[model samples]
Target: MQWKTDGPRSIPQAFPYQGSKRALVGQILSLFPTEQVPLLVEPFAGSAAISVAARMYGRAQDIQISDVNAPLMDLWRMIIDSPDDLLDSYTKMWHEQQQGENSLVEAKAYFMLKRREFNDTKDPAILLYLLARCVKAAVRYGKNGDFNQSADNRRMGARPANMQERIHGASRLMQGAKVTSGSYEDPLVNAPREAIVYMDPPYQGTTDVPDHRYLTGLRRDVFSETLQRAVDNQVSFIVSYDVVREDNKYGEPLADDLGLLHRNVVVGVSSQATLVGRKEMSIESLYISPALVQRLGGQDKIDDLIDVEPKTQDALF
Candidate 1:
């Protein structure tokens, strides 16, 4: 069907992220205001996929991305400010990967070595390589706030040519974006009047998963409070999550006071879930601000706003 980012360098969505909205970039973007969108703010910018795509597709000319994971933010800043240097270091290390006999063991050992390098220097290249080599691109960390994910043998990380192109492609989209390292609340606190804020924070349903393991039980209340302020200021927002509780699944809905608009957004089967059993379907409710809703024609429900079909369930797989 010619979806964007289906292959290497196929779309402006350049970063290879774990749960990227790259494929759903179109669907997510369908909700953008037809009027001028001044800024695109993504607080939990895991891979900055949505932010970059929004800029590339003209949803917004400016972007601001932040994450509590400082090292992750460091990678984006490096890509934005010095793509060539970051790519050079990455290419050098990527070429150093082991080949032939016992390659898996050798490569895993080398990955840990580079991870240590990333920890010591906070080098963007090392982090990029680690993310590509780590299991399912998931970044797990210990209670000590250190990366704890082991290498995955099942995957062959992207080759250097593609990876280099990715860095450059992302750099192009980042030309006018602000990259920061701090809490998601910081971005919300400073959200502009005409900005569109999308929060894809750690999902409450997957606390056991590696990506959410470290961040769970930390920011629920604080996030709710900060969101309230954004609401008070009439800032636009689209939060991905819903209040749900099932057999073994549980999800949290947005704070009631904000009274944001919402619609179901079906996501693909989780890669992490696939490892444990058969693929499991997941769905999120995108809670949009009243201001954004009115901008989209003040409708109670828009066809593009809610996608419940299985067709969209694998957008990121």
Candidate 2:
């Protein structure tokens, strides 16, 4: 299925992501009932995929995208504000890395090296484009905030065609969005009461690499306090988290304690051939405040608002 948007036609349908909700943006938007465009805040806005989709589908007006990772936040700002300069720098770096003129280990390594270097520099847009090229699509990092993933030699496809055009198109679409670097809880302290907050944090699970610090030790307590604060302030919120089996020690209890309406949507976790070796599935559990649900009119209308279009298996994997 073709996921259409009211943005640039040159933008590629496939983005660099392992568990991207690019297909589920429409569905997530449907959960909201207010016609007024509330400020949409994505605290852990990885790749800003959901925020981009929310804007594209006309779900929200202004978006506040934030992440704890400085490099990732720089990338979002660049993608939205300075597409031309970013694309030019990315093209030069990519060409140099491709010709073996750079000491970069591979395409993925080259992508991370550029991001690391860009983080310390003043130019943030260039860092974003370089990240899109590197990072194994998932953008994993070690505890020291180091990009330490091996290149996926098998899926090293050519640089996306019309890169500049797509960047410009997306930038135009995201004109009003703001990107920032900080802890998720710090920025939302004074958010508008009517605003909608979407939280997609690191899953509650063990990591293969002992130091693969995706969330910096965000446990159930932190998530609980965040939700309680939003609830007290009458802020409508939606949280997406993985579903662990009943036997597992950690699972739906997190959502249960939040005291909000909950719903589960199944999503494919494997888009790469290498990932197919592990039969993994991702479940998105959306939690909303009870008052917001009633105020939005009803649950049925909210359900109809969100939609998901499954992509062709061949196209994604």
Candidate 3:
């Protein structure tokens, strides 16, 4: 199951993730170093969606993937180490909840139990199962870092075939990829010479306050130095963060003093837009280091990657 660009749109198959980059992987991959990058790293491996694209497409040789969330990494490690066993266990659990006269009740009960039992069990498969069955495809946590998100409002989960494909695909992506549990800094500091590092950290917030769920908030000012460190050490890094919209909503732009090249990827209004009669808005900026930009084969490729859509400027006014 190779990661493919020639798919339905440019979206490759990915696990159910709330902020899944399935829609954006195509564009991101197109911007990776056009030559052989020794190592490809995703520090914030939420679903490891981008690396899956790299693996599926044969983009790089050595891969290093990690995340701060230990349990989430555990699930991915399980799939990579024992794809068949994890798949079997997940399938059984999925079907079990569909049985009995009170199937919906049974399903809800099952989800809650797994949600509660996750920390204790540290069962990779259970966590993966819940990610599919959980609300909004989200993974939220309490201050103590417990699985605090609720179960889905609906009765049915994803079809058996769908889950199986994603399980297999993720397993394939994880093969030989250095999956680890720790802060993003380790991978950045220890990155292979000329490795291409793609980072999607807990977002910088609009209120300048961290979303309690994504508590591993980064300080833009400090983080800019982090990106610089990666570059100074000869590592190519790309970071995804909030960019001001045409209406100055969604989130504030990365601090202007960083001296990094940013490309705005326009994402239209989501269904959950808050304003009563507001126009659609939300754009993410990718701050790429100069060395990485140079490695991406001059301004032509960079221009394509930054391929900004025709946005109405009036919204900003």
Instruction: Give the per-residue lDDT of model 2 (tens digit) for 1-317.
Output: 12334433222332354455665564566665564357888888876677776666667889998988776677667777776667776677657566664444565566556656754573655444544554465555676655554455444334645566566666776787988888888555557777777777776663445655363657777778877877777777777766433232245456565678765554445334236474444445666676567767666755555433123333222
Poorly placed runs, candidate 3 (over 4 Å): 1-4, 7-14, 206-211, 243-246, 267-282, 297-301, 309-311, 314-317
lDDT of 1 at 157: 77
Clashing pairs in 1: 268-313
**How many residue pairs clash per model?**
1, 5, 2
What overall lDDT, based on C-alpha atoms, would model 3 receive against the true structure? 0.70
What digit string (tens of lDDT, one per residue) describes model 3 on residues 216-315?
A: 5566667667776776777777787755554554556555665567777654454345445666555567777777778877655687665454456664
Worst 10 residues of 1 by lDDT: 1-10
Each model's TM-score, in the order given?
0.84, 0.77, 0.85
Q: Is candidate 2 or candidate 3 better by TM-score?
A: 3
Q: What's the ranking of the predictions by TM-score, best on top?
A: 3, 1, 2
Whole-model lDDT values for every prediction: 0.70, 0.61, 0.70
Q: Give a tens-digit lDDT track for model 1, residues 1-317.
A: 11233332355544556666665565567677753478889998988877887767667878889888887888888888988888787777776877647777778778888877766787677888888888867677765556777788765477878888788888887897888887777687668877888887776645555444444334577877887888888887787664222232256666677787655555555444678786655555667777778777765445545564344324422
Clashing pairs in 2: 26-307, 27-306, 27-307, 30-305, 30-306
